[model samples]
Target: MQATLMIYDGTAAPDSEIPRTGGVPLAPEGFIWPLCGDCCGGPMQFFAHLPVEYGVLSVFLCQNNPGSCESWDATAGANRVFLFPPAGLVAVAVPESGVTLLPAVSAIKTQVVTLEPETGDDDELPPDAYDLARSGWEREPGEWFGKQREVLGSLGGSPSYLEDDRLPGCPSCSGTTEFAAHLEEGIDRQTAMNLGGQLGYVFVCRPCSEGAFLTD
Candidate 1:
């Protein structure tokens, strides 16, 4: 059967400056296949590993939000799964707090484990590191999702929300919040899991900010 062959050259890194030629080989059936899509039919990029740090994290702007885009905040609502190069599908359910670390290959080389699921022996994951999500639909409904366009609209896209001295303008009132506090309490690291773990983003207004430890 005379059929055009499709192939993906993973080794051959294509240059961004280089343009594709129409004469290039086209495979009738591509080497790779579609993975997942949003409800609005927008493509979703399933990543291979989770980001250890928050800044370099991968974000999926959901093209399926009704009348708006649903940008799943990785730390807030993303369903993280380790993608295998060979396996067609595998899942690693994560905590609602997001992934802490990509576990090194060990007993979980092939199978994906659900979050905090009691395996009786508890050999699935270590006591300290983070776990991933098995599926997007399996995420907790507590993710406070709002109108994507409206959320960005309130922020003015400052491009420096996380930067030092800059604050992520609140979407509720579109008000600029001051740097509140870093929690000097000695129990911060001691009871990390108790007080919502660690204090990450704690913004407050004039009254709220002053109400905190003003001695500093």
Candidate 2:
């Protein structure tokens, strides 16, 4: 039988997967956010937009909450929402319940990032696994932040989704992680830095915290 939803390389999902909730900005607005991914009561704000080859990702975090509920989940239509752990991955939702782990549509990413009147029918990426896990299959590094959905995808003609405010664990290890920029003025020179202090409440792994440079 054909799967109801088709998961892309855990990256691109169909346009239909995006939640069409009105009155909601691309990001959650004025949300008191009493619960973090770990269910901690705190304020989670708009973080960042991860522009992948397939879609624009949105990630959120709450420093106040330990790892209790720093996760994110939204329903656009009949499809469930989630985020892939690897750099590029996407997947479609399947039948699931309290104890049953649902299966996914696709696994690898087509690395396709274009949705217009045309070019929509051109490219596609097979479901790419970051690693492998139980259920229909999962990316590697099993210990994922329970706060966020394991994987999510974007299909043509669907609202885009992505990873945002991703806390940098070790840029040296992860390569390039996005950060809020800050400009510092010196008598003879100016310097650009990563915002860490005031923005500390944002997203940054434990190590990145040591190398953070606050913004103005």
Candidate 3:
């Protein structure tokens, strides 16, 4: 049983302290761009930049009119999750006219696979450890499905919690929801996001900004 995957690769320049997703946003030089309490007008969709251990958690997602809003429901209004504080970092603030940054950063790497479980003899064990790491990426589905869809998008860590009931609830008050983000599978494979190789997961209930999305 092993699990340590952080293998982005759409570009680079992120490591102000691990926990990343889209890019550009160590916020505070003037920090401004967090107003989509469900489209109070616009400006939401930054989607993650974490830097925890005492600050920095930025996440947003209204997606304009993406499927008539409701983001998923967290409370309706889509998404938003701030936290800042490492002395407030800096830089992010240049939208006097247009703003929606979230597609220009990527290039992490930290593989460490070794969750084996199938060794011939008619192999057939995988029933846990996230299906034995998706059966070791299906034993190389044409190069791990194009490197697992270019390391999908926004997947810093904490997955393979191995079916915590598959995580999802709190459509309003059902409670028990808080995983946050990991939509992965996209770096432009023609608009990726298939997840056929598994990943999705977004859960949330932050006071009910409501949200849920599974794919495992």
Candidate 4:
């Protein structure tokens, strides 16, 4: 029997000029660490380095004392997102004190099983660009994922409307939340946050600085 190659889930070590996930964030030369406001007094975890047609988007998450830190609130100092030009790249300076970063980051490497799954063999559609890119990583993990890197915006396709029963309430205000960001696994396995084969969804309560993450 052939051994299956499974997806990877953890912070990645990236080479220069290549955008990656789970490694040190690329920031301005004089960039200062983002301090949390939820009384945790710590630096956020570097989650992703997204390079788009215009600029790069850096994402961070704060889960220090998740029980009381209110990291879910976008306004509670739980997470931060930064956008800037790639020309101004610099490694973030880690602070001597406070929570500097998360111990681990989610990563994934997908193996192609079937394009649309073998559903009764009625009709066959070739795999789309997103699906092929994800599978292509198995051939050349070092190659840059052009458009796939930006799939987080619309999840490479339309997002399903999640029902209220499946959604989570805001941790801070307990109000209904709205979809904020689609957290897809990054260009490589190290930056991929596996959600049981589903894309990750982020919802936020802007007024309370609270947010929620779940698989859709």
Instruction: Give per-residue CA lDDT, model 2, range 34-81, as digits (tens).
Output: 223334444432222233333333333333322333232221011111
lDDT of 1 by residue, 77-183 (tens): 21221212322322322223322221111010111223443244555433211111212112456754321111100101112124543443432344664433221
- Residue-level lDDT of model 4, residues 124-180, one tens digit each, is 653343344344433544765433453333321322445557666675667876654
Over all chains combined, what TM-score does candidate 3 have?
0.29
Lowest lDDT 10-residue stretch of candidate 3: 149-158
Residue 142 of model 3, lDDT score: 54
The C-alpha TM-scores of every prediction are 0.18, 0.20, 0.29, 0.50
lDDT score, candidate 1: 0.22
Q: Is candidate 3 or candidate 4 better by TM-score?
A: 4
Q: Write the residue-wise lDDT of candidate 3 on 86-143 in tens digits.
A: 6747757534432355545554454555665556445753344433543354355556
Ranking by lDDT: 3, 4, 2, 1
| Ten contiguous residues minimizing lDDT sum, candidate 4 | 1-10
The candidate maximizing lDDT is 3
Task: Report the number of the highest-TM-score candidate.
Answer: 4
- Models, CA RMSD each: 23.0, 20.5, 14.9, 9.6
List the global CA lDDT of all models: 0.22, 0.25, 0.53, 0.52
Stretches of candidate 4 exceeding 4 Å from the true structure: 1-16, 102-181, 184-216
Report the C-alpha displacement of residue 49, candidate 4, in angstroms.
1.0
